[model samples]
Target: MTKLDDIDRAIVIATQGGLPLVADPYGAVADALGLSAEVVIARLDAMQQDGVVRRIGVVPNHYALGYRFNGMTVWDVADDHVEEAGRRLCATGVVSHCYQRPRLLPDWPYNIFAMIHARDEAAATALVERLATALGPLARGHRVLFSTRILKKTGLRLGRQQGGGTPCSG
Candidate 1:
């Protein structure tokens, strides 16, 4: 496993809250960390290559942007075909996020979860219907739970900045 030192950890922390809106955002981070912009950019690139960071991008507020309807579509797919079905569902532009999660049994346990968004309920429902048709009869048991409110959405905190040491756990 690759381990990050103080400098690497600092770079990760600095970039997590969305890149600064500037002519040279990475350069801004480098200045904040007292390092050269080239070094910060290089380290971030390396971190991504090493799988330490999945992506560096903005987290847009879809609702504020007019995507008022968001739904969590859960499917109870047979274990053998989960991956195939998931890939197919993800291929749709309407499906923003898709993944296979363990079923929580009676209370939950649908296995497949997808985050879908649209301008309104009707549009979201139509997209769901399209997905169900694509998945065939297996999608008959799927459930769509449209979101009523957003409780929270924030960046993951990987580490702390204490004792002049590396701040993140990764």
Candidate 2:
């Protein structure tokens, strides 16, 4: 990893939220940063090569985009098979994020979690069923936790990514 200079910091701060939605998003960022768009693109390319940027793209607001029903589905899987099951769940396309997480003893027993977005709960549950079939008996049990309201949706924040202190991810 390399220390971010002032210019790099400026670029990071300028594009942290995401590239501008326009015909020339990078150019827009460059204009704001007082640097050439070429420089911005080159820096971003280097960042990706260095693993400083993990992903870059539009993150649709599922709810606003008519994906009205989203479920944070959880499953209690056999410890040895959770990883493979997670991969299968991710391949389902309905799953936006899937990973294994710690479970609280005596209360919460789900070890694997996947987020599913859909137009309705039934549709989301159908995806969960697909995941269950993929996992077979390894998935001992499961539950789809649906949010009743949007209490919070944490937007992108800087300094959360690895390898660099800069904010930009593109």
Candidate 3:
């Protein structure tokens, strides 16, 4: 495991929930943490290289953007073709994310899951049809499971700052 310095820990804590939504997010974080924007960026970059940080990405709120219906389109893809099928689905610009999972026998057989967002149930159904056609021979079967509610989305975070001071404290 990568041992985090105080400053690194602070950076993680500051960003774990999400980056500050501002013109200059890093600068905002640095201003709050008593550090420079460059320092925060450098630290985050180093932490990512060291595997302390995996990925930094946007978590779009589709519902707020008029995409009220979000469906998890599970695909029963042939093991050999799953990778290619997933790549193709992602390339279609319909899927927000796609991943492969272990299939359970008998009751559950889906191995590939992709998420799609639409404005309504009809749109969702249309997207499912489009995706099914896209999958073609690779997918044996599929299901569209709509999300009933929102779930908390957060990143890695520490408990809290131990004491109030510059995160550079050693």
Global CA lDDT of candidate 2, please? 0.80
Cα lDDT tens digits for candidate 3, 86-156: 98899889998899999999899999999999999899999999898898988899998999887877754
lDDT of 1 by residue, 8-83 (tens): 8888778877788999998999999999999998999998999988887767788888988889999988888998
CA-lDDT, candidates in order: 0.83, 0.80, 0.88
RMSD, one per candidate, in order: 2.7, 4.6, 4.6
Q: Score candidate 1 by lDDT.
A: 0.83
TM-score to native of every candidate shown:
0.85, 0.84, 0.90
Ranking by lDDT: 3, 1, 2
Residue 95 accuracy (lDDT) in model 2 = 85
Query: In model 2, which runs have C-alpha deviations exceeding 4 angstroms?
Result: 151-170
How big is the positional error of residue 132 in model 1, measured in Å on the Cα after superposition? 0.6
- Assess candidate 3 and give its lDDT: 0.88
State candidate 2's TM-score: 0.84
> Distance (Å) between predicted and true CA of 142, model 2?
0.6
